[model samples]
Target chain A: MKILQVEGLTKVYGKGDAQVKALDNVSFSVEKGEFIAVVGASGSGKSTLMHLIGGVDRPTTGKVQVDGKDIFTMNESNLAIFRRRNIGLIYQFYNLIPTLTAEENISLPYLLDRRRPNPEKLLEILGLLALTDRRTHLPGQLSGGQQQRVSIGRALINDPAVILADEPTGNLDSRKSRSIMELFKMFNRQYNQTLLIITHDEKIALQADRILTLEDGRILRDEAVRA
Target chain B: MWLSKRALETLSQNIRRIVDGESVDLLDNREGPLSILRNDIQTLVRMKQEQADALRHDKERLKDSLSDISHQLKTPLTSMMVMADLLETAPPEKHAELVRNLQTGLTRTQWLTDALLKMAKLDADAVAFNVRKADAREIVARALEPLNILLEMKGQDVRTAGEAELTCDVRWTAEALGNVIKNASEHSPAGKPILIACGENPIAAWISVTDSGEGLKPGQIARLFRRFQGDGTAGYGIGLPLAQTILRGQNGDIEVDGSGLPPHVAELTDEEYSGATFTLKLYR
Candidate 1:
């Protein structure tokens, strides 16, 4: 099933001559459980593309269909729910609630759904993330790597249809980076989870099942790896 | 009687010195039964001091653990209460969002509680491993089964070679291999093949899962198996470590060689990119 579809996606910042087309006429579709890596240099609108697809920002012109529903057509409130329930967003800086403990941040999506998190699933996730001990530690108390894990936990907690990560491992060292990639792969395989990651690292990009290279807000290449 | 009084006085002085954290040489100038008494007292004091230190350390650890638990619980509780208050006064349109936020808070608290309980069990070594002889191919098959759907979605294939019979707790070993294979499969690109080669020697049985992805750097290879050692990129640093623990319990070990070419060039190489090769070895 095609879980995410982006068509004619465009986002302009500022106005007139000062207007910046961060993402210019970008169009792509992601299959369910597909692991995609988006790579581009700085100022190529990589983050902008992510934000538009994530519904954190609206596209100036275009359509985004998540699970066949036009996300832009929904009202702001409905979009918020859709984003919470279907889209799991991960960032380089983690963006965790500093005041909340690791476990709280992971379960935020569930809380947003006004439902209880499944205990068994939660335990499995904590075990998978190796966060059993750090569950109680606040983000401030956690190391950079640990905080990112919590953020990833938050993203996975909802079992969203699509996980959109922007430089999810940018701040991590190579070991952490490898582990993080392994984790994304684990979820993609174990649960058939769909992933769209934006990264600048060539090595990281190459791990994806499909590599999408963006240049100046346009897709320069969308190639599959031939074994 | 005079000698006995003198000995009593020395003993009292030595006890005082020990209590004050000062060193005392009780047997330096003594001989006979007095020296023996002095040696016994010194041993007794040393044992008591060690016990006190251990107790103090445990107490400190317990204190930190309790504080962490309370703080973890409090944050969600506080957030939920705030959300509930907002919900009460929130406009009808805002109520749904607030309710969602409120529920998220409760869910976090619940997850934390459950995670803590499981962690406690793992810490207490409450999980028992059932070790027995099993077919290595069967173990690999079981491990790869869950990932079949994902592999098919990615248009990837896992190829297994060689076969060996080994003594292991099939379930736990499979779980460990599953994690390793999952890691390898994720790093490998679509259409790329993940190779699982099994072999046995006089002393051990081994399986190596290799992927054609960007191999790990030297530093990364060093810390790959450490628990909670994520680089803040993707993982919580649990799976591999758990796999390690499981293997270790079964008299087995995991090794990774990430010295292969970069992931991009790995595709061009006939040697499977060497991005990473995780080898699981179990002693016979």
Candidate 2:
């Protein structure tokens, strides 16, 4: 099943003289459980593309259908609710609450939705990330890798329909990066989570099922790594 | 007294079923000591079922391995028999060629048996790996050393880059890497360079060989490392499985990715296909 369909997405930042085309009519569809890597250098619109799909920023001229629902067509409040319920976003910087414990940080999504996270699922996610022992520790006390793992747990707490990660491992050393990648692989293989990661690193991109190269606000090439 | 006797009788039957490696479903939803006993019995039954399933899976795998190994040996054996039969009535002019053919066949058969025997030993936990800290660079060099003659003959080039210090059974790791490099060379076209690179992520010290040949098909990945499974025509098919066995013995693994990389990863202007990469990793 195709879970995501991006059609004729074009995002222009400003008016005539300072007009910047961040994304230029990009179109692609992602299947329900694909692990896709979007690669490009800086200013390649990869981030813009992610923001648009995440419904954080609406496209200037196009649509994004996620799980048969056109996310862009929804009103702002509807999109916010839709994104919170379906989209899990992880960032390069951990973006965790400074004073919140790892467990508390992971429970933020549920807290925002005015619902409590299932205790069993929260424990399982923590254990999967090997963060059970450090669940009580604040983000300030955790290492870079541990912080990222917590962020991953937060993303996964809702069992979101799709995971949108941008430069997830950019802040960590190679060793930490490998461990994080293994975590991603385990989720992909075991749970069949639909994941789309944007990275500039070719080595990291190689682990994904397919690679979409972005250049100058346009998709240069899209190729399967393991069809 | 009658109810207690019946309960004991049912419990005995469940124990017997478990002893026979059969699944037992005990129906006791009552909230009492009897229910607790039933809960424990249910857990045991689940464990027994899992064990039986695992044993069946193992047996199936063993059967497949045996069949594959026999097939590998049979090919060379059939060729050897035909050549021997020709030797008996061959003219003098063809005698040297026929003898050489027999020698080649014998050597190939010998190598196959030798590799299989080593694998069997590894599987049996007989070989004590002498682990030590070794330079990834030296290991790559050692792996490529024996391939020099064969690669030169095949008109292939190898490019080695990057380095990391890895703690492994240096000699055996070199042996395992050599197998992967050899597989890569076999698939690569003439004049194309096989790329070998090594580096470390915090969790692992690694080496990878990317061949500039046809990559793996979608279904091929599942069986790519099994015994006697190779890209049908090129190899006797022992190398990858053996490499996996060796690395796994040392707390490591091998990953093969032939996903169509653009021109840069394994590009030669003349070739239309991207090469697959086999990475040998030893975790830190």
Candidate 3:
């Protein structure tokens, strides 16, 4: 099933002559469990595209349909709740709460919704990320890689319909980068989760089932990679 | 009744001793039924002591690890916050530099987080390796392919030789070699040719990447694979360690030869090359 559909997604910053078209009328659809890599040079609107799809930022002129529901059409409060429940976002800097322990951070989404975290799923994710031992450690008390894994754990806690990652491994070394990719691939297969990752590394992009090349705020090429 | 009362008193005394953390000599208590009871209590006490000791040790180790993590995270985080603050207060022209510094700080923190995660997974033996037999040449090609852009940008040349089929996890092995190749290429001088050679022995197959870069100092060689031990200019010092973990997972190993000589330089004249060589080997 098409889990996400972007229609005429246009994101413009500023106005008039000083305006910047971050994403220019880009449209695409992603199937459930599909792994797609978005590649482009810096300032090519790759992040803008991700933000739009993730519903973190509104597009000036476009519609983002996730699970056949137009997320952008919702009010800000509803959109925030929808994003919290349905879109798992990972970033280059991890974006974890420094004061929260790994376990608390992973359970943040559930807490924000005033829902109890599933203990079984929490244990499973902690084991999957190999973070069982660091569960009590705050972000300040964890390594950069560990903190990122916690953020990843947080993203997975909600079991969102789609995951949007922007240069998730850009700050990692090649080994860690590969491991993070492995984790993503594992989740993509195990949970049948949809993934849209923005990356500059060709090797990482090639790991995706499909590659989307962006240039000047437009998808220049969309091609499937041979297994 | 009198004998039973005396036995109960003796047993209660021993239990009290055990509870007080005092050593009870079970062998000294030689009565028939009391002897058995004492022996069981002795075993329980010993087990409890061992468990306590193990728990204490684990707690200490965890404390140390947490301290290290805190140190690693704080450096970048502090820099980022300071830079962000400066950017807020500084002149417009200084904003760019401050923002750049902030970015660098953020990048460092992110790298540290990733490295720690991988380290934890490897330590926990939680990572699953998908091993398969594959062509050694193909793996090298895959590893080197991603690096072609970097090599070309640096005006570097690469030469490969001696292909051999080997049993390995193709994807992971490629990643390991890619890290080695990236390290070599980064340290190598511009326009210098990086040589990759593959060969097989009776028990194992190996590939070596040699680069025309300044060989490691003797001190650096000892701590080369040590996590977070680099000069901070090249990288966060996690790549090589992570590669080592990946290779070891597949019964493979990596060796560094910092003698300032390529392994294949024997075929050419002595003046032809001077650099470092890293060799990766996988058991057959």
Q: Give one digit per residue, the lDDT tens place, for model 1 in A1-227.
A: 56789999988899899988898899999876689999999999898888888888898999998766678877676577667766899999999988888888899876654455788888888887878988888999999988888898899886676899999999999867866876776677566678999999977876676788899989999876311
State every prediction's TM-score relative to the real structure.
0.50, 0.58, 0.47
Per-residue lDDT tens digits for candidate 2, residues B102-129, read 9999988898898988888887689999
Over 4 Å off, model 1: B1-284
Regions of model 3 farther than 4 Å from truth: B1-284
| TM-score of chain B for predicted candidate 2 | 0.79
Candidate 3 residue-wise lDDT, B116-169, digit = tens:
887778756798877777887889889988788999999999887677777887
**Model 1 interface CAPRI class:** incorrect
Off by over 4 Å in 2: A1-136, A140-145, A151-179, A184-227, B1-52, B260-273
Q: List model 3 lDDT by residue over A153-181, tens digit each.
A: 88988767788998999999876786687
Model 2 per-residue lDDT tens digits across residues A148-210: 999998888876668999999999987578679867866765556789999999878877878
Give the Cα error of residue A65 in candidate 3, in Å.
0.3
Q: Rank the candidates by TM-score, best first.
A: 2, 1, 3
Chain A only: TM-score per candidate? 0.96, 0.97, 0.97
iRMSD, per candidate, in listed order: 29.1, 13.2, 26.8
**Considering every candidate listed, which one attains the maximal DockQ?**
2
The digit string of per-residue lDDT tens for model 1 on B26-58 reads 432132445445545654664565457557766
